[model samples]
Target: MDRVVLSFGDSLLRSSDVSLLDPPRWLNDNVIGFAFEFLAASLSPPLSERVAFLSPEVSQFTKCCRDEAAAFLEPLALPCKDLILLPVNDNSGPEAGGSHWSLLAYVRRPPGFLHYDSAPGTNAHHARLMARNLSALLEGDGGFREERAPAQHNGYDCGMYVVCVAEALCEQHLRGCDDLILQSITPQYVTRKRAEWKDVIGELSRKSAVAPQP
Candidate 1:
């Protein structure tokens, strides 16, 4: 079967001008624009074969509820044998129904913000976590290894943590899938701002990273 590249996320990875409950459109626009571009660029065939983009527009009606986008990814989980591209029952075979080649690129605001209020804090944490997850997926390739990158649960991890994860994932897991390409496109300005946010959070993680966790 052809390898599949799944791009899954909220407005950040899906919509460009869509709105959430909160206002302050500039920040939201910036966040969503960056992800949309990244996925567009990264999904190039040479980088990956089959590409499936799941965004908030379609997600709003799904049972997963935009907040639980990750759970919606269950269908893409490939058994090891499939992920490795090896015939099942062979010496190099992986677990049954576990070897499908797929990558889940999720983008969204942080966990809280719905009940109380969410600002750049939620964006920052999610950004950090996204980098970490993407990096792990890229580095592990189709291996699905546990993530070892540092915790950027908050925005303080310098976004580099995510970059580092991506760099590593690209080096390992992505190597075997010759066609495995997972690039995240972002404009120079958004990229710069995200970096700036990371710096700010890094300096004040202990004092300012908290965002009324739900």
Candidate 2:
């Protein structure tokens, strides 16, 4: 499963000059950040503009002082838009502690923030902290709400679940679906998505080989 995600990331890096740095194998415990970059790059313009994929370092900084965190985010000049997908990690050391992923999605037509967590109880505090930080970053506009997304059935699939939610939300936004409900992305669905991504990676690799290089 990890290899599948990494291969997808490799394809994205080859296809575009994304902001995410090449992930080191030593950081094998997590590849969710790279996966999010791939998803963000896959989206079309404007919709893609609305999403901000934060590095694990930046996401981790939000857990500390609010003013400092806001300063870190403000310099990025992120688009204040309909949705911001954030991947969260509970621990600092790469191999030391457990990690979970979540999203801070903003719905503009209704004007509110929705914190969607795949593993609900485990990361509630992390999600709220992120919401508060985001609210502060957005200059005191608060109305952060929590919505229980489809829960993961096992321990290791949280990263994949994050990718699933991001994809579903992007589709919903593109189709103009109000409420932005996450689809029924079961574990079986994730397995299938992995297979699909494998094929995508192969196709992209072939295209990259033939395309003229700058």
Candidate 3:
């Protein structure tokens, strides 16, 4: 049986999930969702109230249909958010049904969805579909624009690119950057960022173990 290795907010990573951090292994939804949770928790006031980091399940679920989108997303109160970060997958499902992963973020500043796909155009359709769903909720009309992102040299690194680019964007926003039009992603940068995941998760786990529950 798989044991839980880390739990942060509503996200949980199993023992097997840690193996996905190994070289050439694709990062599954759990890790991405956990990263989103951690990032949201670390944001300061104002930004914290304006930004939202959605989980893979919530993002995927809204893709079903319009009625479902309204019923599901309305409760989340996404319209009031200035920025929303979502990890996109080629296939629409809560499970690891997609063969590829990408990052789709919506910024209310200029009012457009930004897609960062390491596999280039691999997950564009998925990004557009979900972006449309979010768009209708936010402003009733808009389209996704592909942002420059690091291209993965290998198939499995696409997932890491999503995490890395998402981190880069959030880092920029935290540092007082106004727009998501920044680009610093490179193969070497991904390497340095990806190398930190194991230690990051370990530290998070250690902290969770000692924290007082609500």
Estimate every model's Cα lDDT from 0 to 1: 0.28, 0.60, 0.77
How many clashing pairs does model 1 include? 25
lDDT of 2 by residue, 161-208 (tens): 666777787777765766435656877787666556546555665654
Candidate 2 vs 3: which has more lDDT: 3
Question: Candidate 3 — worst ten consecutive residues by lDDT sum?
Answer: 174-183
**What TM-score would every model get versus the actual structure?**
0.27, 0.71, 0.88
Worst 10 residues of 1 by lDDT: 81-90
lDDT of 3 by residue, 158-197 (tens): 8778877776787665456654434566767666766688
RMSD of 2: 6.5
lDDT of 3: 0.77
Question: Which residue runs does candidate 1 get wrong by more than 4 Å?
Answer: 1-33, 50-146, 153-171, 176-214
Top TM-score: which candidate number?
Answer: 3
Instruction: Return the candidate ranking by lDDT, descending.
Output: 3, 2, 1
- lDDT by residue (1-214, candidate 1, tens digit) is 2211122232221122222112222223223323333443464465443333333222222311333434444464421111111000101111221111111222121111110001123233323333333323222332222222233322222222333333333433434533222222223333454555434333443443333221
Error of 3 at 203 (Å): 1.6
State how far residue 72 of model 1 sits from its true place (Å).
9.3
